[model samples]
Target: MIALHCDGSLTADRASYGGLIRDATGAAILAYVGKGEENSVLGMELMAILRGIMLCIQNDLRRVSIRSDSKLAVDILNGEVGCPWAMQVLKGRIISLCEQLHSKEIRHVWREMNQAADFIAAIDTGDGESIFNPSEFPLELVELIQNDADCKAYFRTSSF
Candidate 1:
């Protein structure tokens, strides 16, 4: 099974999404961080899931499980709740992608458990886009990745 963990970050004038895809053994397959043009946090979260789904399709992955910190996104994808009108288009696209996959699972996870992807999304890459294989991860992200693998909690603080 392939496990995809995804997250999104939105600030006053910018939004970004990120995801980490791993194989059944917990080895990283690929990680992606991309900026979203959308202004809504939920929109960014849905876009992140969309990107992760595309990655799975590109890699020919059939058995996939997607986890995210956005309960709204997961609930919408799972048909547990109606998505907002603004998100209907993205919701449709995600549903289409899932139809093509042999098997898929989407679930919500706690923020602490999802820090790696959140860290990736929060990064201020000059161009706001990056894709990394396990060996190609930036030096700064190595420790974050390791902490994620070790299931360590990452706490965030805001500047006053």
Candidate 2:
């Protein structure tokens, strides 16, 4: 079981990505990537989330606690909002997928708490961050984020 979370931020069109990955043991990993382009940030943000979910599916992961920063995206996945026009075709597909995956289990995290995920948006627009297991990151990288709140803060303040 794992509690997987991701966050994304977008400009008018450019989007950034970041994520938190935790295993059953509670150890975690952080990743960030971004896509710079002239697409709606909302689109990019939701794409980031889709990317994360696809990873979990590809790995045969179960008991996942997926999360995201975009309320619109979250609501859409959670069946809270009516399907948008463009989503009409996708609505059936999306809802069917949600049902297949038990997507209601997904949650929302605050933007500030989603800094790592936001950083990911800068990594690979639609491509997203490579799906890495939480156990993959070295203790040094984890410690760096744990010790340096300033460095973590830099992700927000720096130009992506």
Candidate 3:
């Protein structure tokens, strides 16, 4: 099984933020960012969702669920209708992606499940200071989970 979670936050400046949480068999395979483009925060967040879903599909993932804190993103993913003009184009993109993925199941998780991605995405590019580093987030915890050795050990004991 595979699952993904993500979040996006925008500042007053021309800056957008987004990140994703990826999990396979009780372990995370990846966690990272998608930002610095000419997109709104919502658009960036939705893009993160798209990126994660595409990754799962490319990896031949089965039974994948996507989770996110953004209600707009999740609702749009769940076949919601009637979007604003500003969002209509991307909304269409999300719908297309959903169909393309075509997994057995996909869900938008609650805020709790999406905490890690949200935390990493909180960096503010709005201010003129560049005192932040991406490497500081999730750190060894995320690395350990994504590391192949960990997944091997994990599935070795759990595989029936």
**Best TM-score among the predictions, by candidate number:** 1
lDDT string for model 1 (17-84, tens) is 99989888777889899988889899989999999999899999978899999999999999999889
Which run of 10 residues does model 3 get worst, by summed lDDT?
A: 125-134
Question: In order, how many clashes per candidate?
Answer: 0, 19, 0
The better-scoring model by lDDT among 1 and 3 is 1
lDDT of 3 by residue, 78-135 (tens): 6674565777776676667667665734466555555566765665545322222335
Worst 10 residues of 1 by lDDT: 145-154
Superposed Cα deviation of residue 126, candidate 2 (Å)? 11
Give the alpha carbon lDDT tens digit for every residue of 41-136 in model 2.
Answer: 555556555555556665666457777777787787777986566645444543455544643376787776554455444454364346544466
Best-matching candidate per lDDT = 1
Native-to-model Cα distance after best TM-score fit, residue 46 in candidate 1, in Å: 0.3
Residue 38 CA error for candidate 3 (Å)? 4.9
- Which lDDT value does model 1 have at 22? 83
Report the alpha-carbon TM-score of model 2 versus the true structure. Answer: 0.64
